[model samples]
Structures are given as structure tokens and as C-alpha cells.
Target: MFRDTSHLVVEELSRTLERIDPAQVQAFVDALLAADKVFVVGVGRVLLALQAMTKRFAHLGIAITYVGAITEPAITPKDLLVVGSGSGSSLFPLAIARKAKAIGAKVVHIGSNPQSDMKDVADFMVRIPVRTKLYLDDEIDSRQPMTSLFEQSLLIFGDIVAKMIIDERQLDLKGLWQHHANLE
Candidate 1:
């Protein structure tokens, strides 16, 4: 049963990822690479996924931070803000995206809802098109409970973007270890 469930989850994630537009992903990568710094914002499980992305990006030598971290520096026009909210309507993330836009920072929203209020604030969006709380018409249905599929896909999407950056920059895999946290 466990194996069957795992397979089902993987299949669902595969479908969700397959639906993502490659062009949008390329744009996302372009923004991240162009930014002097990257700031991520999300809440709950989505935030957990974003945190993982932040760590992986840092390993690739990108200046990245979670939005509310105590050490988080000021965001400037040269920075990019990445917001992850499956519904794209989460109060905190939406507000932060708006603030980032006001600061002349570039905002990229990764969420399932293209029609969300975030559309107005974000410079662009990388849609996951997965089952969000909004239950939008186009969202891919999931066997998993709640927004599990969206969160899981979001995590993988970050890794995908990281890998793209690695390839595009022709980075040496061994050299990335130098950026990994050594204090642990």
C-alpha cells in the first residue's frame, strides 16, 4: 500500500510539473540570475518549501533569504522577490509583494492562480496550476489531502530552477560544495 501511494503521489506530481510552461520557467531563471539578491516569502507549508529553495540557491552562491529573517537585508530595485502562495491570495505574501513592487524590486509570483490579486502586483508569474484552496477550474486535481500536491510540486520546482541555473552558468558541481554550510 505504501508503495502504491508513493507511486500515485509521484505520478500526480509528474503531471503537475509537466503542465508548467518552459518559457515561464526560463523567465524565472532569468530573473533569479539577474537579481543582485533574491528574497522569498510564503506562509505555512509553502514557506517550508521556499525555505528549502533558499538553502539550495545559497549553495549555488546566490544571495538569498527568507523575507522575515532577522538577518534579511533591505530589498532594493536590484533585488528580486519570489513569493510562493498556492492561491496567490495569502495576506502576508500579497502585502509583501506589493511592498516589494513599490520599492522598485522585481516580483515573481509562483502560484496556481493566474487571476489572483497578485497578478496586478507581480512583474510576472510562474504558474504551478495545481489544486489550490481556491479550487480554480484549471487546477489539476489531486488524490492527496489539502494543498499537498501544490506544496510538494513547489519544492520540486525550486530544485528544477536551481538545476537550470547550474547548467546555464556551466557551474562545476564540485565547486558548489564550497558554498554549502560548513558550521553544521
Candidate 2:
């Protein structure tokens, strides 16, 4: 039963991944590369994923900070904020995205809902078509529980974006190691 469930999860994820548009992802990558400073924000499990991406960005030598970090600087017009919300209606992320836009900072929203109110606040968006609490009407029932698919997809997408930048910048493992924390 465990083997069958694992296979089902993979199958569901494969189908969800197929719906993602590479062009949209490329636009996000281009924005990340162009930004002087990058800020990331999310909530709960989504925040965990963005936090991991923030660490990877640091290792990749891109200036990045998780929103609300003590050392984070004020965002400016030249900065980019990446916000992930599976529902896209989460108040915290939406509020930050709104503030970023008002501050003249570019915002990239990574979520599953195209029609989410957060879409209006974002300057750019990468839609990941997966099941979330708000999107449970999906024809294919997900093996993973509520919003797990979307959260998983967000993590994978973040990794792919980081890899693209690492490759384009010709950053090798040795270079990444240079940025890794010595104490960790």
C-alpha cells in the first residue's frame, strides 16, 4: 500500500509539473538575475521552501534575504521580492507584495491561482497548476494532503531557478562551497 501511494504521488506531481510554462519560469529567472537584491517571503511550509531558496541564493552569490530577517535592508526600486502562496490569498504575503509594489520594487508571485487577488499586486507571476486548499476541485485527486502538491512544486521550481542561474553564471560546486557557512 505504501509503494502504491508513493507511485500515485509521483504521478500526480508529474501531471502538475507538465502544466507549468517554461517561459514563465524563464522570466522569473531573468528577473532574479537582473535584480540587485532579492527578498523572499511566504507562510508556513511555503516559507520553509523560500527560506531554503534564500540559503541557496546566498551560496550562488546572489544577494538575498528572507523577509523579516534582522539583517534585511530596506527594499528599493532596484530590488525584487519573490512571494510564494499556494492560495495566493494569504494575507501576510499579499500585504508584503503590496508594500513592495508601492515602494517601487518588483514582485514575482509563485502560486497556483491565476485569479487570486495577489495576482493584481504582483508585477510578474509564475503559475504552478497544482492542488491547494482553494484548488481542491482538481479532477485528479492528489495523494498528498492539502496544499502539499503546491508546496512541493514551489520548492522544485525554486531549485530549478537557482540551478539555471548557477549554470548561467558558471558557478561550480567549489564556488558554492566558498559561500557556504564554515560553522554549519
**Cα lDDT, all candidates:** 0.96, 0.87
The worst-scoring run of ten residues by lDDT in candidate 1 lies at: 130-139
| TM-score of every prediction relative to native | 0.99, 0.93
Per-residue lDDT of candidate 1, residues 74-142 (tens digit): 999999999999899999999999999999999999999999999999999999999988898999999
Q: In model 1, where do residues sit more than 4 Å from their true spots?
A: none
**Backbone clash numbers for all candidates listed:** 0, 0
Number of clashing pairs, model 1?
A: 0
Clashing pairs in 1: none
For residue 170, what is the lDDT in candidate 2?
A: 85
